[model samples]
Target: MPAHLPHGSRASAACLSPVPWVWPVPGCLSQGAISFQFARPAPPWPAMPPQAQPADAGRRVMLMSLTGLVLGCAVPLSGKRQSQSAWLRPPGAVPEEQFLARCVGCGACLSVCPTGALQPILSSSRLDALFSPQLVPRLGPCAPDCTACGGACFSGAIARFAVEHKPRLRIGVAVIDQARCLPWAEGQRCVVCVDACPPQCGAIQLRPIAPGQFRPVIEPSRCPGCGIREYRCPLPGQAAIRVVP
Candidate 1:
């Protein structure tokens, strides 16, 4: 016969037993006795072998290659789009490809522009055009007699020339929109563009059309495309005259 023991004492004895023991209580005995012990934390999950790491390395290489491919394809397309747009380069600038190759993107030319017409090409999808100098005639017209941009260009992107040679250097051509010109559209007398044009090149001429009515005509051969006519046009929005390269 076993010695009689209180319920709490039996529970304590059962916990202390060297061999695992389960409480006889119906619900408590379902999973057998609970036991605990300390052992080396199952030696840290074995380091991923060198062979396994190649999968991760390959993934990184593939990602880098894809990125390069995307950039390569995008660059040519961006360059093509830029080429098709009207880009008004400063006077004395070389041919498109040569100028792009020679230009160092220094702002020297921009700094020396007397009329503030030369502006930096700040934003462009093509990386090469970024920071290159361009002419924004609406801000201020390039002085026909000034050779500052060519003189300031250390990169030879803009050829250095004397003031005398500037008349022959055609950076772009000015086109008049007859639909927007006041004289052409409304039959009004307007010679603002002709008056503002540099006298050295009589590019814009007022031709007598009807009784006391005159229309502006462009003489391409004499025009240097200095942008004076476009800048001085009196129309409210979008000047009647525009310069295109």
Candidate 2:
């Protein structure tokens, strides 16, 4: 051709042959692999609206109901502290309502009862008295030695275990139902309640009425107020010394 090298010459770029231009000539490769190796583009963001979260009505109701259910179950488990019955209570404890609320009533306090002093109130009493513990001294009397029913009542019915230490609780003050007692009404020779007393506190003391017979009377200062288990006293009405608030 004019001034250019021949088309077959190595000098001609298109016709160059075994020149070994690259030290290690790369093999034929797919463009897809090269593309895959490149960095990816960033993802597009969603376009959701910024709405305010609504209050969960169902969840609130569930929580309220659960709270109510727990409180309902706890009421009876603590024994009838709210009950009108005098027997089922923490002896000597003040601010009774608060004490009973925290009480576990696990019967642990009932076990340390060295004396059978803390007896259970039986069916002979009212229905409200059901499953409640009363101090019954049928076999003997409230052990002069053991008065822990007060201290043991983690519920705080009374303050301490020792009756002496315990500021005299008006648990159930004895009322000598003159209408019932043998000396007062029936005029018999019965001195059971008087003799049954622990002697330290002579709740039922005898007074020489006639020469031969003595009438049993309650020394208001002495009677602890808890009723009898033997069902002996015969008040014309309910016991004169019935439990009161």
Candidate 3:
């Protein structure tokens, strides 16, 4: 396990390419289309100079302002979010900037993970998280038995997890989403999630979901956030899921 983060200082990998640059057009005219002026012979009737048209001037000013706004909105975006973790970077993983620079925004980990711990976030606050990933434990817990993300990560965020000594990671604690769970919903005899957890140092244990029936309850102290430092995840595809920052 790494160091415990302070309250405000902490919050939240994969890689991605750069966005094309967009700039304002030279003229302040509207996006498209133009109006035509009627051609006429020299004005024979009016020998005096023409009067100033404040209204037309104002309209042109308005149009120019609008043109600037449209151009501003059209500017292309820059770098995108990543899906892996910072700590996972190994000794010779590709150059951090270069690797992140070209990664496309596709979530292979989330799709293949068994426990459904991985989730796509809207933004990344720092350089490390750019294009990397976040773990949403509330949504699901990390799988304790397997380290599929390690093997499946093309970017090596989780790296190739060769089930070595138990990992000491402490990503976050689990909180059930009663909405999607079977025991919480039907209130019947079911321990699917608990039965699913690995036995040794179980991150999750069974407790009373109802008066008679029991449901898997997370044991924070024992859980290593998907066995990154332990081995207790209980999901088939993903290790029990986590919402690691």
* Candidate number achieving the greatest TM-score relative to the actual structure: 1
lDDT (10s digit) by residue, model 2, range 77-126 = 65445534444343453444444344444454456666554554455323
Q: Write the residue-wise lDDT of candidate 1 on 80-198 in tens digits.
A: 54332357888889887778778888899999999899888878666667788888888888898899999899989999999999999887889999999999988888999999988
Ranking 2 against 3 by lDDT, winner: 2
The C-alpha stretches of model 3 lying farther than 4 A from their native spots are 1-40, 44-106, 127-131, 164-169, 174-197, 203-221, 227-245
Local distance difference test, each candidate: 0.78, 0.49, 0.47
TM-score of 1: 0.69
In model 2, the worst 10-residue window by lDDT is 28-37
Question: For model 2, what is the error of residue 188's alpha carbon versus the real structure, in angstroms, after optimal superposition?
Answer: 0.7
Q: What is the C-alpha local distance difference test score of candidate 1?
A: 0.78
- Which candidate achieves the best lDDT against the true structure? 1
lDDT of 3 at 11: 20
Clashing pairs in 1: none
lDDT tens digits, residue span 86-152, model 3:
4333212244454454334366666776766566654644433344545554445565555665566
Where does model 2 exceed 4 Å of error?
1-85, 88-90, 114-141, 147-158, 162-170, 226-245
